[model samples]
Target: MKIKANLQNLQKLLPSSWLEKLQYIHSILLFRWILHGRSQPLACNQKSAMVFSPHQDDETLGCGGMIAQKREQGTQVVVVFVTDGQGSGGLETSRDKIIQIRKQEALTALSILGVAPSEIHFLQKTDGRLQELSSQEQQQTIKQIAELIKYYQPEEIYVPHRKDCHRDHEATYQLVKLAIFQCGIKVELLQYPIWLFWRAPLFILLKLQDITAAYHLSITSVQEKKARAIASYSSQIQSLPRDFIKHFLGAYEIFFNAEL
Candidate 1:
């Protein structure tokens, strides 16, 4: 926690752009080290899995490779987008239009990863404001997710990392976790990172347990498919920072195991 506090203080002193660049560089180095480090390769033996994304394109960004590999192995994979993506627009585009555009992009991306259209679900919750949901609204959202879990009964569930440096992502993790517990099921929970790479230092993000619990899914064989899947998010690629989306196209995707 002290490391995170010092980094937060340093962040306040540095230019925003410079700090982001530094974080990105450090993230890259950390990723490379993990790729070669002691983490074991993931075994794709699950009969079924579900991935929860806070936004339209996050599923592809964080779990695209694993999804692709699992699909190839004949594992049933369902993807759920928790938000409506209303905030992903510039001043020119209307909220509803941006939501529709992002939803279409998500469909195309997941299709490329071999997830059937029938298996993709959109919860249509408010974007960029998940943390602002009222107490009753929060329970309603959790109940909705719990219903889906009861229906799917997946052996494994994937969600954004708890400390992903984005409020929506953090909220998604908490919501999904509560839903899992509510359903009273024992399932493997895998947490993947997205914005943390560009927004946080590695030292501040890692806990001792996480270091030993890291898992790597090798996407080398399916990297091209993953690349094409990521490319389907043309809206994000054009609007986000230059090269920001490329970091996810690496040979491996990292996930950390979490329990209840």
Candidate 2:
């Protein structure tokens, strides 16, 4: 659990996907969580928190429960969508149509997570091309994010973690890393699961939820909102397996949020 442990060692023992996951967690606490020390709470009187997601539904699919719990604790949460997710072959015949659908879905999903419409920010980045952005563009994106960081000035910033099979997730992570440091804000970067990590069962350092503590949302509106959000991405449906969506459509929803 030593932060000083060679990255090459982890690289040898774990696949690239798993290694990327650890890199994110390590950034937050430098392996203290893995070493069995007690986890520290955020600064007292914190009111606002931010979540950065690559797609429309990821924020809700990944952390809706914890978001609700935090809101109940009197924290104001802002969920940012990095992309409209408009490049699927199946969801629709046109990109414009997909964007329109996704925007509505995002608003509905954020509402389910207890966020007001004013709290949502859409960056409108192209979905699926997040990593292909040029270095120059990436730098500019970082600078622009600094302005946003100043505006929100959230003490807790959650971004998609590395090891995501989806390119957008990785790009969003890189942007968040650069922006937070550039803005000189010492916010904790929490990772949310997307394609590759959903089936993942364990983490080397942190486990934010336990089987005993896992609770289902009782409000049927939350489930409906989740469904509406997922359905909003008409363009990306082709990328998802039919079986995956079939199994996912249910009243129950669970998620994990852990800082490295």
Candidate with best lDDT: 1
Measured over all alpha carbons after superposition, the RMSD of each candidate to the real structure, in angstroms, is 2.2, 8.9
lDDT of each: 0.87, 0.62
lDDT of 1 at 259: 72
User: How high is each candidate's TM-score?
Assistant: 0.91, 0.65
Q: Using alpha carbons, what is the TM-score of model 1?
A: 0.91
lDDT of 1 by residue, 123-238 (tens): 99999999999999999999999999999999999999888889999999999999999999989999998876677656566666664578898888889999998888888887
What ranges in model 1 sit over 4 Å off?
A: 1-17, 89-91
Question: Candidate 1: lDDT over CA atoms?
Answer: 0.87
Residue-wise C-alpha lDDT for candidate 2, range 1-260, written one tens digit per residue: 46325544656789866655554444333223322243333222345778888877778666565466566567888888887668654574588887777788678767755688898888887888888878887887777777788898887777665555567887887888878878886676666545532332234323444211222333343456556656654444555544345334544333224332
Top candidate by TM-score: 1
